[model samples]
Target: MGKLTATFLKEIILLARDRSGILVLFLMPAVLVVVVSLVQENVLKTAGETGIRVLFIDHDRQSTGQVIEELLSGSGAVEIVKDVDGHEIDEETARTLLAKGDFQFCIIIPKGVTDGVKKRVEQQITEALNAGNEAQNEPVPLPSLAVYFDPLVQGAFRASVVNVLHRVVLSMEMEMKARALSNMIPVRMNLILQEIMGPNLINVPVGIFPRMDSKWGSERLLDVKIEPASRGGVEELPTSVQQNVPAWALFGMFFIVVPLGGSLIREKQDGTMLRLLTLPVPHVTLLSGKVIAYVLVCTVQFSIILLVGRFVLPIWGMPVLEMGSSPAAIVLVVVSAALAAAGYGVMLGTIFRTYEQASMFGPVSVVIAAAVGGVMVPVYVMPEFMQKISNYSPLAWGLNALIDIFVRQGGIRSVLPEILYLLSFFAGAMLIAWGVFIRRGRTGG
Candidate 1:
């Protein structure tokens, strides 16, 4: 314990003396988080302003088709474009517009839609009455509402648009049914009264149907309810802050490889490693102390970056960090992530032979990993192949874990898989580094 403490203090003192390392470890990540957050916020705001574009082609040109068009045109979330250059678009033209990125989706309301829906509703009610069963019979087929979408559009957004169209069609169907029921009541009631009282007994013909209660008379054939994924009681943070803070922080943590590896190379080249081996401290203890010191440094780095996101950025008129339900889970992620990064640094330090090699390659490799791991761009926005490959980056694991805690409002169990992966990376790198050190000792190199 005493020797480990001594070695730990020695490493801290040495690292503290290096001003450049201190700046990189502390200041660089904070600056990056703020800058990236600002940029992402702006991008999101601009994208929100550009509402989803859709093409509406109405062959019906009747009341039903006109109703749908009116609903879509008035929607703030969707923009409906009907024509180009004072010419109406057909299905083929709509497809062309979609291909050209003029619209995200297309909807075609087929001809005779309003008349067909009215006919279908009449047939449904007549069939139900003839069968002496009010059990909901299947609705008659009407002209289909055809939807065509650009393959490039996101599946989730495309599905949302489809759902909106479905609701519109359903409402139209309901209106037709209500009208059919109203027309039936007077005829059906007169026939029953004539049969009971004998023909010409009353000498009066009924001309009106009594008003029916909407709630009891109207039974919706299709009811669609949408539930969002976010659970209650958990505050969702801004996308920019939730994503950028952890991503940039992970990038900075992994960059500790540059200084840590360079220091090792410097010691090995100057024969300081040989001198340390002769001292009373075991070689393993010496390595452990360096690892411990850097782990602390990484923790500090993580904390500073988070503070900037939570407190400092908000004052600058940017989004503030919204914490998750589990503070303990967040701390666990930070510690595990820091260990993984420090372990990687030690492995890099041992593998590289010179300070120049370590300094050049360590930061470059970290930057590449950061780019792939969603530090620069989100993984979801990347091509499918790139997203699959991003899983291999340890930094990706760390960033995902942090997001689960902070944005997803997940508990400790929710991020166990990511935590395990990070620990495995630490263990694997540390073992390889240990082997390299053992091989060097045996050869006196």
Candidate 2:
């Protein structure tokens, strides 16, 4: 234990003395998080607050079209704006606007919409009243509302507009029915009364349809009930920070490979390994001390990066990092991730033959792994094929576990899978390093 402690302290001192490496460890990820967060600020807006810009072309100069326009304008989910430079635009121009991303969607209310709706409603009611007494009327085709959506808009936004349009259609149909009934009911009642009373009784008041009116109130034609589910207690960070902070931090953490491999190569070249082997301590003790020291180095590295995200970045006009509900679980995640990174560095050190080889291979491997792991782009935004392959990257698992804690407000159980995967990577890497050492021992090289 004393020897291990001495070796650990020596590793710490050597790592601290390297000023340039320490700078890169802390500087790169901070710059990335700040730059990327500033650039993608709009994409990280909260749900229901996204103001989708829409172009409304009301061709039907009638009440129904005007009502639909009013409905969309009032829906808070979207913003209805005049075309570029406040110029009036037609359907073709609106389509062009949608293509240019000036508008998220285009709504075209076709001509004769009011006439078409009334026509359909009258035909349906007449057919219903006279069913079996005469041949049914053929269904009238109503004019369709043309909706052109930009392919860039999310499907959820498009679906929301579609739902609103459905409500408009239902409201239009009901308005036409109410008008038809208001005019037809009095005439039909008078006819029936004259037939029953020899056309001589006092005429019933024209407004006596109140009895039926009370039974069929047309105020709310569609009753939409929403049963909302309970949400989590924690407030999450913007999507960008939630994704980028840990992602780039993991990228930086794995960069420990450079110094770790370089350290091994430098010691081997100085005949330090031979000298250590001649000491009383077992080979595992030396390896354990090296891994332990670097793991602590990695832990400090991660904590510094996290502190930048939590405290420093916010001062630079960026979102502050939310450490989540379970700081203990966060500690576990950090320690495990650091262990995996350290083990990977050890494996790289054993595999490479020289300082140049270890230096070149270490950073290059980290870049490839970080790229595949979604440090550059979010896994959610990646193509399906890329997302499928992302699981192979250990950095991806490390970032995922961090996200579980940070964004999902998850406890240890939620991140257990990711923790286990990182531990597996650490175990596998250490075994390979051990195997390489055993091979070197047998060959006496």
Candidate 3:
């Protein structure tokens, strides 16, 4: 215990003296979390929170255009920009503005659209009512609405805008068709009454049919209920801070390998490792002390990120981070993650002989693991093969465990598998490191 404590203090003194290492461990993660979370929040808001400005050129200038404008404005997902300065936007100007990305998209309502749609719908409905007659009317083509989008717009956002426009147009068509059918039904029934009861008796009560619901096109009988899925049975709202904070913090934790591995290489190159081996203290104790010191640094680093997410980010207009109900679960996962990271560092230090080798490989390996682990992008959104492969990364285990707690409102029981995986990984890494150390002692490498 005494030797372990002394070794621990010695490592702390060494780390504090290395200002650059301290900065990398503490400052880098803080800056990364803040910048990334805010950027993501803003990007998400562009679709809904802040309305996207869309160019609207209504050549129809009739009921069709007016109804579309009213529906889009009511949706509040986008702002309709009809003109530039005081002049109305023509198709050419709208296209030019879209090319320049002045707006994400443009909507052009063709001239006489309302009349053309009404005529086509009434004609189609009339032919349907006159089915089985030898005289069939010619089909009338419906005029189309034109929409142009910027090349830079994302496919998902573009699809969303196009879908809204489709809904609006479909609603208008359905309403117009229903009204036309209502008006034509009485005329068609009067003709049937003349055929059945003769022209003089057409006004008889038998000619009248039941009144149809005029609001069938617009009135909704069934409504869709939206709710979030969560295991804890509480509705959970996903936020960028919840995702990026724990993700980048775990990233910073694994990054401990660079400094920790470099420390080991520095000790060996300067003969400090050789001198330490000659001491009465057990080699295990010395190694344990370094692990403990780095684990503490990892803990502090994670806490700083959490604080930034919970307090600092909210001031910058991001959602305040919500720590899960189980603080103990958070601590347990953080420690397990710290141990996993430290073990990997110890293994790298044991295998590599120079600071350059350790420094370069440590960061690159962590970054690769992080990428596979759903830190940069959610694993569920990745290709199926990548998602299956991500399960192998130790960083994936830590990140999944943290997300379960922070976002899913999970407890230790929920993250037990990940905790076990991380611990087993730590044991395996430490074993490999120990074997390499013993082999080096025997061969004097």
- Root-mean-square deviation per candidate: 6.7, 5.0, 2.3
**Residue 342, candidate 3: C-alpha displacement in angstroms:** 1.1
Give per-residue CA lDDT, model 3, range 1-445, as digits (tens): 9999999999999999989979977999999999999898987788677777889998889999999998888778878998899998998998888898887899989998988888898888888898958486777786999999999988989999998888877777777777878777877887787899876773745336665655687666789999988776878777888889999999999999988888888787888887888788876787899999999999999999999998899998899999889999999999999999999999999899989999899999999999999999889989999999999998899889888887788999999999999999999998898888777743334
Best-to-worst ranking by TM-score:
3, 2, 1
| Cα lDDT tens digits for candidate 2, 387-436 | 99899899999888888778777789988998899999999998998888
Estimated TM-score per prediction?
0.65, 0.74, 0.93
Count: clashes, candidate 2: 0
**Which segments of candidate 2 are over 4 A away from where they belong?**
1-21, 35-41, 44-47, 136-139, 153-164, 167-206, 211-244, 255-281, 312-319, 352-404, 407-421, 441-445
Most accurate candidate by TM-score: 3
Better of 1 and 2 by TM-score: 2
lDDT, candidates in the order shown: 0.81, 0.77, 0.88
Q: Residue 118 of candidate 2: its Cα lDDT?
A: 76
Residue 43 of model 1, lDDT score? 58
Clashes of each: 0, 0, 0
Stretches of candidate 1 exceeding 4 Å from the true structure: 1-51, 70-96, 132-141, 192-208, 213-240, 255-281, 311-318, 324-333, 348-432, 442-445
Q: Which ten residues in a row are the worst by lDDT in model 2?
A: 209-218
Error of 2 at 137 (Å): 4.3
Question: Worst 10-residue stretch by lDDT in candidate 3?
Answer: 202-211
Worst 10 residues of 1 by lDDT: 211-220
Any residue pairs clashing in model 2, and if so which? none
